[model samples]
Target: MRVFAQLFEAIDSSTKTSRKVAAMVDYFDRVSDEEKLFAVALLIGNKPKRPVATTSLREWASALAGIPSWLFEESYYAVGDLGETLTLLMPQQSRPEETPTLKAVFATMTALRKYSPMEQRETLYTFWTTLRGTALFLFNKMLTGSLRVGVSRKLVINALARHLDRDEATVAHQLMGKWDPLTTRFTDLFPQQGTALPHHIPYPFYLAYALDREPADLGDINNWLLEKKLDGIRGQLIRRNGELFIWSRGEDLLTDKFPEFGPLTTLLPDGTVIDGEIIPWKDGHPLPFARMQTRIGRKNLSAKMLQEVPLVMVCFDLLEYEGRDIRHEPLLIRRAQLAALIDNPALQRILLRSEEMAFPDWQAAADFRERARQFHCEGLMLKQWQSAYGVGRRKGDWWKWKADPFSIDAVMIYAQSGHGRRANLYTDYTFAVWDGDTLVPFAKAYSGLTDTEIKSLDRWIKQNTVEKFGPVRRVKPVHVFEIGFEGVQASNRHKSGVALRFPRMLRWRLDKTAAEANTKDDLLDLLRLYGQ
Candidate 1:
């Protein structure tokens, strides 16, 4: 546990990827196999269920520190993080005679749910006195399920692959599906004999980076394959050993969520895995993304609801066929195989192949890209004809040329503090649009500002605050910001009767005033034009 805590500090304090990877590799080298397995699980966001209520934890910490509850609350508001607040407020303890193991600590946490609240508090107090410094901080964070550091899953995979002297793609593939760290072994995760993997496991998705240059800069359009970038959940449909499994890119199991696709288990050949997008289809076109959200997380879907928002997996590429892995094959060959598999009369309604778009040149492609919103597509995907399905995100082979985001000038009406590094600054903001003489809150954005800009705006927000409501401050609407979003739709839940998708600050419109900002009518116009 002490070594793991040191590793946490080392990872959190550094911004360099190489330094972080080195720290992880060194930690893996020194830890037990069980510790390495759990560490990998935690690093990849498979956190254990939080066992204790945060309110109870805060009250117990304040009692242990001999500080008043009001003082602790004030400290938490200032700290902006419960874990950090508890670490700073609690009194120091004497060093333990022996350090605890990560697995033991995890076991203790998982068992807390069986105890009563009083028993839980007593156990936590006894456990808290045995640690000091980073270990104590990490323990609190683990209890709160907020142990985040500056490392990507790719970096962790890289470090593990280097330490084990294994292929990076193999290590990545091993980490994909459901596995219990408590029972899993390091050797089981990365086998030496090229053992068969679990049938439910998915391959590491091949992601595309955004294209920054013009399409014409790529040299020739004939050398690329073009397809509409559908706005849907990217998933992999696998049929293995007469069983069907649909895994989202986030690693969520969607088999029961979309029962309509269950027939594909018999329709598709054994040991076939196809990569595609799961979209809500109606009348041969995709419904709005907002409509798709209605069918998500419904374990038992009503027949009426399924009929209204039917889902179809638009196949893009074939990953496996007839029990063989074909990811190394060229895109041209893979697409041809996928087309042949999806061209079935029985699978027409449930599975549709993403049709390749034809264009004479880059100029024609650009012109077609402008009309992507009409077909409910995000934009165009350009894939190299001879590219292979690689792991994670790689440049040069696949690129996403997205349509320009819709922009509107809106006024900053409320401000809130951010967590982690921006804990002390007013980095989150609520934007409003004019509704006659009233200002209606439309969107809240928290990104797209430089460090200098955030600091400057934080100062302005502190001075312009009109009223306080807990962590949120109602600020005077004096500054205007250009807010950008991918799509807009009519929403009864919003005060403006509209909602924006992926809203973020594009730039600070210093030359514009609150009075000159866009109105609710302008948002309604966007909904009419882009709304499904």
Candidate 2:
């Protein structure tokens, strides 16, 4: 536990990628095989279920610190983090003579879930006394299921690749699919010899970066393959060993969740994997993303719900064919094969080819992009015809040219402290639009501001606070910001009778006043234009 905590601190304290990778590599080299497997899993977002309730922990910590609950709440609000607040409030203690291993800690957490409340409190008290400083903070974070660090999954994969003398892509692919880190050995994950991978495992998705320059800047139009960027879940549909599996880009096994595509197991040949978007389709058009959300997180799909929000896999790329990996082949050849494979009438029932756009030049491409919203698509994807299907995100091969977001000037009416690095600053804000003489909260945004701008606004927020509501402060509506969002829809759950998708602050409109902000009527107009 101490070593893992040290690794966390080393990675968090440094901003350089090389330093972080070195720290991870050194840690991985020193740990046991089981410990290494668990470490990799934790770093790559496979955290265990939280073992204790946050309210119980807060109560226990306050009692141990000899402080009242209200005082603890105030400290938590000021700190902007529950784990940090608990760690600081507890009395300092000496380090244990023998620190527990990471595996032992995980075991204790698993046991605590079955323990009674009193037993759980006693175990936590023992942990608080033995662990100190960063170790204690990390323990609290794990208990709260908020163990986040400054490193990316790619950095960890790079470190593993360096430590094992393996290709980075190979290391990434080995980490894909569902595997129990507690039982699996590190060697089992990355074998020294050639070993067969699980039949259900999927290849790492190829992501595209946003287009920052003009389409003409990318050279000849014929060199790029254009397809509409559908606003749906990006998934890999695999037909392996007479079984169909649908895995999301997040590495979730969603075969059971999307049983509508089960026919592909018989229709598609064995050892075939296709990358596509799982969209909610009906009446020969894509449904709104909001409609798709209804089917998400639902384990048991009713017949009515399935009928209302029908699904289809819009395939774009072929990763494997005839039980052989063909990611190195040029995309044009792969597309030709994918088209031929998906041409059958039975396969066409649940699968549709992502039609490529035929454009003479950049101007015609832009015109097609403008029609993306009409088809419920996000934008157009431009892929190099001759580029290979690479792992993770790579530049120069593919780009996503999205339509401009809907923008509106709104007033900042509520402010809250941020988490992690921005914990001490008022970085989160709720914006409102005019409803007659009233300012109705419409959207909340926390990004797109420079560090200097955040600091300046933090100072302003501290001075202009009107009222306090626990962690949130009802600030005076004096500041205006231009908020940008991809789409808008009517929502009865929101007080404004609408909701914004992917809303963020575009810029601080310092010249505008609260009264000059947009109105609820304007939001309704947007809903009428864009809402399904």
lDDT of 2: 0.90
Superposed model 2: Cα runs more than 4 Å off: 94-98
**Which regions in candidate 1 have their CA more than 4 angstroms from the true location?**
94-98
lDDT of 2 by residue, 137-211 (tens): 878887888888778989989999998988999999999988876677788889874788888999999999999
Error of 1 at 15 (Å): 1.8
lDDT by candidate, in order shown? 0.89, 0.90
Cα error, residue 528 of model 1, in Å, equals 2.3
Q: Candidate 1's residue-wise lDDT over 248-285, tens digit each? A: 99988889899899889889999899999999999988
TM-score for each model: 0.97, 0.98
> Superposing all C-alpha atoms, what RMSD in Å does each candidate have to the true structure?
1.5, 1.3
